[model samples]
Target: MSSTTSRRTNPVDIIVALIGAAMFGLVLYLRSIEVSWYPVLLLVAAYLVFAYLFFRRQGGFGGVANPKDFYTGIVLLAVCGVFAAGMFDLPLGRVARPGVAFFPLMLLVLLFIFAVAILLSGLRNRGEALGPVPWRGLFIITGITVFFGATIKGLGFVPAIFVTGFVSCLASQKWTALSATTTAIVLTIFSWLIFIWGLGLPIALCGSWLRTALVALGVAGESIPFCY
Candidate 1:
């Protein structure tokens, strides 16, 4: 039975995988010489299609009504879609002097591979009981992430981080507002110190409006660089 299942050929999977492999090769070639945005975008798109087809063929969501498989598959697909969309128009650098998107694109490819493994494992263990899905927690965390991304530019790094962290913590039933606030504040400060001050990262501590207000109040220098 196992052999028969393994021997079963899904033409869609084969075609998609072939296309993905071709795209991967092209990406590698482009990386070796001159990197461009379009080719990389194409590669990512091909990979996404391949992933969808492959997972769908592998008894989609691990044989229907399996919440664990469904959740895992959905999360992986969502992440891949987000990454591809975010990186689509970004420039890709050369092999010697790679651009900002190079490493991230590579990492995203690895993430796709990892997601495939997860899907395969889920398929193999389809018989196992997948407990109830935590819809509240999932939605809460996702909302917090979206909120952070949307508000970060306007609120600046510190405030955005604190708000997101506190709200995300509240997703857990055990956390209270006070505890979440304290933890969020401490974590935000720690991250600021570590990533900004100690590491000399160019993260903005305050937005333009806040900075202007502080300067006007004589609380900050007029020439406040966005990075603290």
Candidate 2:
């Protein structure tokens, strides 16, 4: 087929796009009015019905051929399940008081709606091929974050920040060890000054044991702020 033919606008695509835009506008309107969860739930049900019709018009479940769409749908569904589970015990406070659950629940509802839309779109547009996953980049980033979280408390703010930055930089093919190390040091110091000293956040700069040792040796005083 000619490129022009392949690129021709599909009515299904236009309809889905219009519906998505309308849904987004409705979300904004609902936000302004501070509507209750019950109404939002009703809207979600209505959207699902619309989504079902859209999917059916596109050729039903058998039409979905792209792996990307398959994975995206799975991820969105997983997220929806997690948020729904979390909402079970969450308190829906009054409009004036609006408990912690209020914002999360709203977000959850929006996510569910969007997820369904994405899944349906994927099913409709099954002509596209899936791209390769960047496993190396993904693993490196995930590992660096995990390491930072695991070691931050024991290693102190500066050290943890430095390590996180260095590792993250190394994840990219462009960064050399020396350049990454220098950048990491500069960033760690800069962040420490801003967030720890200036903002006076209550993060521990050093571990409890290290702080105790410093005090005993008279290198630092007990009254020194943990954050600094």
Candidate 3:
């Protein structure tokens, strides 16, 4: 092999490998402070595995021939790393009963497996060139998420989901005002029935803020819609 032969390392893979290395270092530092968690061990093992792959030039780290799978793998690997870290805070209970993070951790594991499979495919099969990102859809979805989170408590689930559904429908650029409004109404009603009536969950239809604002404008409690 010529010394001048350029290595075709994927930038995405390099980024992921670097992240894993950083995480490994962080976990070690955490352990130094007595934050010895189970996920920390798993993450250490994961980091070592990636470091092995990265150095050996296996799993597309040698050269990413399939950019699409490489990038998708990077995204999923990032997701798994983030959520897996969060699992450190939750207790992994026994078989008779599961902790809050048990199911989520299991799901993350499954996601990680899938991500690994997708990554391995890059070593054999070549995928089509990646397309331009759907910025419009991404922006709309991100805005919707932010709105839902910000308003779910203050605006209440009913109005928040309704507005979310409504805006979501309109985001397609094909939904008319009437169509979006109708879909929002149906979505809101069905969700309310399933979550509130059927499950008997303690989600409020309207929040106290709405009632206070309405009352400030001279609307009585009896006149407020679903605020009682």
Candidate 4:
């Protein structure tokens, strides 16, 4: 491929690829870290950055936003920060299984309340203007992420990629078996090399029990005993 042939692709494509590379790299770096809250922080930051980028790409942040989105985001940020802090701080007696779970629950509640408030306020204010959400794209993206997160460890990269990409393509109404299969394989290889070899992150490529054992050992070996 000539340099001019490569240059035919837009800068946006390059930027997006770099973002994905950085994110995957960060995930590996994060896995190596001792802190539990780093994932939460990374997730929150990713959401914020993506949200801002989406709005910017769409021209602006929705409509004449007085304090709805900003206020909700700020409140949720505080809630997420608190829960993240609690879950990560071992001496605080907050366990991950339950403590980390509350943040999503809180988010659901906040989302519900925010939606109701926005609806009522819009009704009272008479006129309202907001950009249409790309529901199809959002649903596909979310489904893919959930599928990957849930199945990555147990299924490893291959099956997880197939499942996630196929299901996501189905959700997005662009189901193509060949395309999905090819994409999944490519992604799995990319992820494996990047996570396992490039960054040295510990993800289970072995069987479930062995993986669990290894992870437990890793955690145990990495942990420092607390002294009162």
Candidate 5:
């Protein structure tokens, strides 16, 4: 706590923080500032949680003694619950025309199964120690998703997708800066075409953040859609 030498990577704490962040993000995605007063409170709460988790008195490998599968299953179950809770907001259209929740709900089904099995395996002592977690990979992937979900309203679809893509590429073992940039660019363009032009979704190409900056610069800010 007092010295760098006293600090160590605490993946469990990190992962729990990540999950909390992810849930906060999910709340944003579901509401997107539609609700008043509470989101700010939630943001402040999330900050407190991360601060406590990251800055609390430190130790080596701060996780449970259970096998990796156990905690992994537990986390997955938590994730499933988060998604399942939100599934009600999304329309569950018929099989011919699936709603936004359809795919995620289906995946949650599979995840529930896998989470249970892995958790059982962990209880059975069939897996290795929960140490040496792929914390970096998990952090990169989940962290980016959480960031995207939390910022999508402010960043909008294209920017959110691009940022998520770039950060996600960094998680890959064979990623280069050029490659990541190119991929993000291509992804942004394709998404803009699909979600903007093709689907005609209400998502803004340039979100409120850019719109506000453009407004400050006296650059066609009044014409911006979804900047409200």
Candidate 6:
């Protein structure tokens, strides 16, 4: 493809890669500082990068000056500014709860704000500048996420993540053995941090279970006592 055609086909890929790298770095830094919700930030960056790349490759989100993009950007800007204002310097500590209602309330307001923004943009543009979202891969990915979240505790996080990654990648019809294995490893590490370390949740690794069994057998053998 010519440069222009390539640009038209995938203008957002570079942005997506950069965003992914930056977010990965951000989470690493945040974890080093013992910050809460680092995984949530990583999740947001993942979804954002995916959405941008997905839409651009499908058809550019109706071009650079697209109203939908502008509206989305505006709503995001408002969310940052308004939610911060609402959450900051509050006297909610004086109340019985001793904590601000800001976080939950901000989410509700932010959702409404985004809905309104999209509605207004659609109304103003009359769907002229916006294309239908490219959702072929998205639906499969969503299902994988749902399945992973629902089964992780019961199946073990590592196993659940491995299945999720393989299925998600395969759904894109772009999977090789190496890609599937790489995805599984990356997601397993992510699950270990987010569920095991960050949340203090017990999520056993399938490999670790085998290791435990071997250790138990070794200990049983060592009960001969003089070997200690």
Q: Give each model's whole-structure lDDT.
A: 0.69, 0.71, 0.67, 0.50, 0.64, 0.53
Candidate 3 positional error at 59, Å: 15
Residue pairs with clashing backbones, model 3: none
List the candidates' TM-scores in order.
Answer: 0.43, 0.54, 0.50, 0.36, 0.45, 0.34
- Arrange candidates by lDDT, highest first: which order? 2, 1, 3, 5, 6, 4
RMSD of each: 10.0, 7.1, 10.3, 19.6, 17.3, 16.4
- Candidate 6 segments whose C-alpha is farther than 4 A from its true place: 1-127, 171-173, 185-201, 206-228
Model with the higher TM-score, candidate 1 or 6: 1
lDDT per residue as tens, model 3, 74-145: 899999999987787787654346557656755665566556645644543544556688777788888998
**lDDT by residue for model 2 (120-193), tens:** 55565544555477777788899989998887777678778988898888778788989998999899889989
Give candidate 2's whole-model lDDT.
Answer: 0.71
Question: For candidate 4, lDDT tens digit of each residue in 81-107?
Answer: 575455444431133333444445335
Q: Counting only residues 3 or more apart in sequence or on different chains, how many pairs clash (N, Cα, C under 3 Å) in candidate 2?
A: 0
Q: RMSD of candidate 3 to the true fold?
A: 10.3
Tell me the deviation in Å of residue 63 in model 5. Answer: 16
Find the candidate with the highest lDDT and give its number.
2
Model 1 clashing residue pairs (backbone):
none
Predicted model with the maximum TM-score = 2
State which candidate, 3 or 5, has the greater lDDT. Answer: 3
Query: lDDT of model 3 at residue 66?
Result: 65
Task: Please report how far candidate 4 places residue 57 from its true position, in Å.
Answer: 41
TM-score winner between candidates 3 and 4: 3
